[model samples]
Target: MTAEEFEKEAFALRPELKALASRWLGTPDDAEDMVQDAMLKLWAMCADLRSPIAPLARVLVRNICVDHMRRHHYTLSIDTTDVPDLSHGAADAECIDRMMAVVDSLPTAQQIVLRLRHIDGMSMADIAKLTGGTEVSVRKVLSRARKAVREQYLHKM
Candidate 1:
């Protein structure tokens, strides 16, 4: 289809797609923006899209909303400058070394899961996909790894 025809077809599905995006993102403006972006992408790929446009548009807009959500996902930030120093020195380094050893002692899957989550800074969803497991399973592996390390650290102390 031509750019004009693609835009027209995409426009017909805009309200529905926009509402879906709004429900996910909790803002009409962002929802509209996502819909507009999906349209532009579809326009670029219009000639290549032989399938019906409505379902494609709906999936594209929803995926856009999900990507937006992921990009804006909240994460806890640590600022040591705001924390009172409690003499974190050689003792802390030793503790971190012990913890690393403990993590190394864990089962391979748990170790990989823990490293992927904290060291490589991958999201649980991503780790799960990489490890061929569900998100819950990945969480379980990470939890077990942490539990092992904590247990070893506590016992050492």
Candidate 2:
């Protein structure tokens, strides 16, 4: 693909990429930075790109987000001291804590896939290529991951 085409497609997918990044990275700033880095990498490799670029872009974004998360050393530590008590009540707080715990419990691969597809808004085809899996496999992984999260975390709430 041409640089122009790559840029256009990357721009089109930016929002989705950012959303995925946000979920994986847990912050908007990190997500944007990861997406930018992914775009830069994609742009630099534009010459070798295939016709359908969406999957490639998604994979690139996923890789970048994972890299950022690893580099930053994000763990399951939940220090709630900084957060102020809200008027919404104790149930909301408990729910949030439970959800975080569930997210923390997920396997790394499932977490990454869930974030990229649900949070990042990436297409399954793109997720498959990014993760080096088939489309059907990616969908199955996502479905299983979602089911696990819902059953283990959300269902209890």
User: Which candidate comes out best when scored by lDDT?
Assistant: 1
Instruction: Give the Cα error of residue 46 in candidate 2, in Å.
Output: 0.6
| Per-model TM-score on C-alpha atoms | 0.47, 0.48
Model 2 steric clash pairs:
20-120, 59-130
Give the Cα lDDT of each candidate: 0.83, 0.81
Clash count for candidate 1 is 0
Judge candidate 2 at residue 9 and give its lDDT: 82
For model 1, name the residue pairs that clash. Answer: none
In model 1, the Cα lDDT at residue 6 comes to 73
Regions more than 4 Å wrong, model 2: 78-157
**In candidate 1, what are the lDDT values of residues 1-157, reduced to their tens digit?**
8767776777677888888888878889999999899888988888997646888888898899889888999344676554334385557777678779888888999999999999999999999899999999999889988888767766765
Output the worst ten-in-a-row residue range by lDDT, candidate 2. Answer: 80-89
What tens digits encode model 2's per-residue C-alpha lDDT throughout 88-137?
Answer: 57677676788778977889888889889977999999999899999998
